[model samples]
Target: MSDTRPWIYSTDHDDPDPRTPEPGHVYVQLVGGPLDGQLLDITGYTPEERAHGALLMSNHGLHGPGGRSDYEPRPGAPDRWAGAADTT
Candidate 1:
């Protein structure tokens, strides 16, 4: 199967939010992707900020302290490209 795993993003250094987050809930880049690969761009940040490579909103619902089904992003919407900002 294609790799469709969920990538977890968090702003907390130690303890992240306990509640599960819906897909598309963006967290600024706390880290960067590989140097040679196409880094997923995220809005709400600068090029340097995007260079950091923010987390993609996971399709797999919530996780850990935040159980699945706890978060829900704008379902049935097209995936937003990186560098896009939250309009709402």
Candidate 2:
């Protein structure tokens, strides 16, 4: 099946250091398959989802450079984030 849901790469921050995550910032890879690799001010995720996102970041590292995990967007969610996929 075609995975239309957006994927999250790094929900940490657009900081110079990829190892550190900003306090309240999130880096979403795609929104409805658009705006890839954009840094969003706020995540359009529920409280539980937010927490899960944090865990995903922590467990998989700030950017998950190793392709550890892929986050899918919630159903009927709005696009309010940024981030592009890694080409290399």
Using lDDT as the measure, which candidate wins? 2
Could you give candidate 1's per-residue lDDT for residues 1-88 as a string of tens digits?
A: 8544333343244645323344664432212221111222244666564433333443232332322221112223323223322111
TM-score of every model?
Answer: 0.20, 0.21
Q: Worst ten-residue run, lDDT, model 1? A: 29-38
Q: Estimate, for each residue in 14-68, the C-alpha lDDT of model 2 and write its tens digit.
A: 6345434357665444442233443433346676664333222223333444432
Looking at model 2, residue 70 earns an lDDT score of 31
Question: Candidate 2, residue 40: CA error in Å?
Answer: 2.0
Angstrom error of the Cα, residue 84, model 2: value is 14
Q: Poorest 10 consecutive residues of model 2 by lDDT?
A: 79-88
Off by over 4 Å in 1: 1-44, 61-88
Q: Go through the candidates in order and give each one's C-alpha lDDT.
A: 0.31, 0.39
Best by TM-score: 2
